[model samples]
Target: MPPPPNYPASARRNGEEGVVLLSFLINQAGQVELSKVLQSSGSSALDEAALSALSQCRFTPATENGKAIAIRVTIPYVWRLNQ
Candidate 1:
């Protein structure tokens, strides 16, 4: 699974924190494809950062009947400002 995305600086200064749910397809070649936000964190910057980070992720593709297959997945990203 992809690690949590970095908190955006703009968001940090404004104290933005929440979970963003992303939906994407994992291709047979173990690549993240067509990523989009299924839910929002109430901040456009946070949402954009989450999508940007999600785009950089690579995954072990899902398998079916011993063969690699594309699968849709949802990932939740939590962004909290450090005190």
Candidate 2:
């Protein structure tokens, strides 16, 4: 999977950090569908970056009875500054 978004410079300078939770559907073809941010990281910049990262990734399609199926997944993105 692609690495999480790079920390926003402004956020880093301002000491902002938090987790962003998101909800989206993985389609039968292993493509993201209907992506949405379910929770914010308290910073719009961070949230957008997370979403952008997710958009660039392709998930493995779920399967049932030897057939590919869509699945709903929730992801949490955590951002923390190194000490």
Candidate 3:
């Protein structure tokens, strides 16, 4: 599994919680590129943190005809504070 984002202290204190939907490219090199937030988590801190963390992930590049290719994908990062 990819590493999880660090919860921002201010956001945590404010009890902010939501899902950040992100669109990004997984390049042929299995590296993340050209990421954008497609949906906000209602908190900039959470959104930014999700972006920063997910950007560090390395994905298995999509393959076609036994060759790697870049692909654009959308995924959600969920944030919630424990009760």
Candidate 4:
């Protein structure tokens, strides 16, 4: 699925730009199970946005010895202000 289009306009207006590190556990069912913010963007709004987007993301399950296995993945979101 495509990413959500709910980014806060204020963040852009304020020229907010930072990296959000997201840690999530991909279950055997190829679905996102646990999601957490490994690193934040300093701004609560940006962090929340990154977390929300990641929560809705789907990923291919990890494999171990030719079988699906739960695994952890880290995603980074770099939000840059339009120049």
Candidate 5:
């Protein structure tokens, strides 16, 4: 799947960088099951957008002994505005 769209232009205009810490559950089918924001950027809009984008992502499920298994993964999203 394609990457999530960039944050809104207004977010860029604000010129703030937010680090979103996300915890996601990867299922055996290589689909994302659950995603939660472990750390927020103090901006609800940015946090929600990051979560939404992540939900659309697909990943390779972790394997153990050559078998797929559910696992939790942490992802960090850094949004920086170009000056």
Candidate 6:
């Protein structure tokens, strides 16, 4: 499972909440080779925090014809404050 993103203290203090859409390439080694923010959360701190956490993750490599292959994927990371 992908690790949860760390909530930035500044964002929490400001009650910032939004979804960050990220595009990344997962290589055959199951490592994140490249990543970028496709959509922002309206808060740089939250967006950055999401990116940093994602970089530390490892994923199962995609397979093609029984061989591991790299793939590009996009996903949304949601940030919300607990009531």
In order, the Cα lDDT scores of the candidates are 0.87, 0.87, 0.91, 0.77, 0.78, 0.91
List clashing residue pairs in candidate 1: none
Looking at candidate 2, the ten consecutive residues that score lowest on lDDT are 1-10
Model 1 segments beyond 4 Å from truth? none
Where is model 5 more than 4 Å wrong at Cα?
Answer: 1-4
Please provide, for model 1 over 7-80, each residue's C-alpha lDDT reduced to its tens digit, 9 standing for 90 to 100: 78889999888888999999999888999999999999999998988788888888999999999998898887
Once superposed on the true structure, which residue ranges of model 4 sit more than 4 Å away at CA? 1-6
Clashes of each: 0, 0, 0, 0, 0, 0
TM-score of 5: 0.84
List the lowest-lDDT window of 10 residues for candidate 1: 1-10
TM-score of each model, in listed order = 0.91, 0.90, 0.94, 0.83, 0.84, 0.95
Which of 3 and 6 is the better model by TM-score?
Answer: 6
lDDT value, residue 28 of candidate 5: 97
Q: Taking the tens digit of each residue's C-alpha lDDT, what string does model 6 give over 17-80?
A: 9999999999998999789999999999999999999999999999999999999999999999
Give candidate 3's whole-model lDDT: 0.91
- Cα lDDT tens digits for candidate 2, 1-83: 44777888989999989989988889999988888889999999889888888887888899999999999999898889883
C-alpha positional error of residue 35 in candidate 4 after TM-score superposition, expressed in Å: 0.9
Query: Which candidate model has the greater lDDT, 4 or 6?
Result: 6
Better of 4 and 5 by TM-score: 5
Shift in Å, residue 62, candidate 3: 0.9
Residue 26 lDDT in candidate 3:
95
- Kindly report which residue stretches of model 2 are placed more than 4 angstroms away from their true locations once superposed: none
- Report the C-alpha lDDT of model 3 over 1-83, residue by residue, as the tens digit: 35888899999999999999999999999999999999999999999998998789998999999999999999988898973
Model 5 residue 76 distance off true place after TM-score fit, in angstroms: 1.0
Alpha carbon lDDT of residue 16, candidate 4? 76
